[model samples]
Target: MTARTFQATNPATGQPLSPAFPVTTPQELASIVAAASEAARGFAASAPQLRADFLNAAAAGIEARAGELIAAAMGETGLPEARLRGEVGRTANQLRLFARVAAEGSWVDARIDHGDPSRKPLPKPDVRSLRVPLGPVAVFGASNFPLAFSVAGGDTASALAAGCPVVVKAHPAHPATSRLAAEAIQEAAAQVGLPAGVFGIIYEDGYELGVQLAQHPDIHAVGFTGSRTGGLALVAAAQARDVPIPVYAEMSSVNPSVFTQAALEAKAAALADGLAVSISGSGGQLCTQPGLLFVPVGQVGDEFLQQVAARLDATPACTLLTGGILKAYQQGAAGHLAKAGIQALTQGAATQIGAQPQLLGVPLAQFTAELADEVFGPISVAVRYEDLTEVTPVLAGLEGQLTATLHATDDELDGLSDLLHAMGTRAGRVVLNGFPTGVEVGHAMVHGGPFPATSDGGSSTSVGSRAIERFTRLRAYQDFPDRALPPELQDANPHGLWRLMDGERTR
Candidate 1:
């Protein structure tokens, strides 16, 4: 059956600029998921080197067409050229990094135990266990990050690296960019000799297709990045399944910031500069932007707010991702102003598809109630506190956050133990004297947190090499002959990977 098509529009100029995209119906989408399910089996049995080769080639395909990717993303998203280019580079590097992770062969977390016939207790049977891919994954494209969090993004990269086939739901806002990325993946799959259904991309403009894809019987897991409401909807859909599957949704987070008295006294201006940039950059579309700034009340707090206000006023209005995002930002700005205690430190006008920077000041006494909602544009609310004791309650009111930041001083360091402890309970990543915008994709970056920030913290992370584990589960093979055991679990350790053997860590 032929699917109806839609045209992609340029956010900045409100003009159509697509090569045209076909929005898949539920039945068509279900068939794609089933194909991925079948492809996952063959891909999982393929050698790790083979999978790694496909990932590397996919990166090459994106890099080869970097110009088109960047231009298409720039048109769909209002982001500048440099930022778009950087995201393109990040998307390619992420794919290459996963390729390296696939080649490492140690992520399986292999373990082995030989039969103990000599022990006084009954002889134990031999046990060998290693992680294996869960199955086909359904990844939802993100509106903010077309390439990095969309087709061939971290979710797709990690799932493919785990040897699972992927069925991605392309974001409607950037169909041209999504199509470009999908082409790269398909080309790489064919070049690397991957099966026909190794990768599939389904496009849709509404919630029906996403829900169908999530509830599809063949899908073993789901990956998503978006608003709290959207992520929660996907979570609910996945749970309603008879055999529920895990959904790793990187959702909402109003990442908070703290400034101690001592730090505020010395580096007030510097901290203000950093906070202003982090809050307003990319029109506050980044999940890690410091949305709440807590300042110690007094002359220091007053001066800090003034400095940040100056920066905010100077920030020029930028084109947002879409009309919907602009409307939400306007509603948030209007809501903050209507509040009894909320004060607008800096204000900007809203256009049909544009938003200016907004900075509001919320008093400490009323901050907990007034600033609980997230403002998803170039905005940040500064909260001023009279007593140090009041700080804890405000932090307590926050829902789970992706990051909590503090720009502190040496004198205040000793007394921050309690604040650090409190921040640890609520945030996934804590930054000392720094902004939370630039998340490094490395071994230790935790880009998720408790509910609202992320759907699942125990099972996975949305960024870094550790994300590969989200698509795999452990299986134990007992009483198998040496040759029958998986190569990684064998006594010889042919993979040269670190493993837990006979109750000891060995290679």
Candidate 2:
């Protein structure tokens, strides 16, 4: 089959960044999946350490070309060079983290329940359990996170580490960057002598191919990061398949931050500036960006409003990712401004394709009635309440979010522990005194939440080694012969890694 290409255009300059490519056909997608599935059978058989080496090499390649990738990403996505560079670092760091996780091997949760050899009753049968790949995984790229959630981003990295061949449906927003990253991974695979089909990229212009990819029979699971509507649509399609598969779809959210009276009193000005930067960071395209601010009533709230207004005015209007996004931001902002009793506290001068940060303030009741929802841009809604008692009810009214932050003094936190717990239940991450824009790739980071935030609330592949769990499945080698066991889980302990024996953790 012949390969087709698509053109990438710079959103900021209205110039063609790369030639357009033809969409991957259903027949081609099937062929790609067949090869990937075959490769996954062998890749999964390889030692975990070998897989880790390849992943680490991929990280090195990404770091080596960080500058070139960042420049291309910035041009294509209309993001600043600094932000793109930071994202590149984050992308490479995530790869390295996953590599280490794969090397450790315990993430597979290998458990061996040896027969009670000396039991008074009949000896129990040996039972062992281990995680195995869920076969070929289909990942849908995200527009905002061209690197960290793109072609070689968390989903792809985690799937590959889990021994699942990955086929990424590239986001059209940054095709050139995606192609470049995909090339790096292909090189890493070859250097490690991994199968060529272990990683594949499909460039498509619309959702039709993505839908087909998710519904394909050979595709065992899917990883998606995008809008709520898009994610849910994929979920529906997956469910409709004859043999339904799991879809780990992380949707959108309006991460809310609550400021207690004491914190607002202590550092209103600094907090205001910090929020301005967070809201406007990457033009507020991040899923973790704090879109709603809850402020206490009285002098502190008034002071915060003043500081926030100043910051918003001072921040410049930079170009957004695309004209569609800019138009959406304008429309969403205008919709809120048009709502009854909603007042614009501060409005920044609009730019041709980008918008300056805008601050809107309204009465607690009125704002909650009108603008408490997400607008998906560099726009923040400040809602003031009479006291702490009014905060919980408002937070409770919110949809599930990726993050919820609290700016509070120690005393305030102590008093609001219950409230914080309640808020924690509603959000994936409950942060204190910090904005939610920077998501750390650590064991404790939970980057998914309920409903609109993410389709799966019980388990989120957000941070740490657990991210690979989404692309893997548990397989029990019940009462099977030794020859049937995979090498990684053999009795000889070829990998020299930790495993569970008789329900106890062991090395």
CA lDDT scores, all candidates in order? 0.86, 0.83
**Location of the lowest summed lDDT over 10 successive residues in candidate 1:** 364-373
Quick one: best lDDT, which candidate?
Answer: 1
lDDT of 2 by residue, 443-481 (tens): 667778877788887367555568888987888876666
In candidate 2, which residue ranges exceed 4 Å CA deviation? 1-6, 117-123
Query: Over the stretch 1-507, how does candidate 1's per-residue lDDT look in tens digits?
Result: 576888877888988875778888777777787788778778887777888999999999999989999988898887898998888889999999999888887899998888876767677888899999999999999999999999989999999999999999999999889989999999999998888688999998788888988998889999999998999899999999999999999988888888888888887888888888988888879999888888887887888888887887888887889888988888888988888788888756566777777788878777655476787878888888877667876787688888888778777778778887788888899999889998888777788898789999524689999999999999999889899877788888876888989889888
RMSD (Å) of each candidate, 1 decimal: 1.5, 2.0
With candidate 1 superimposed using the best TM-score fit, by how many Å does residue 484's alpha carbon deviate from the native?
1.8
TM-score of predicted structure 1: 0.97
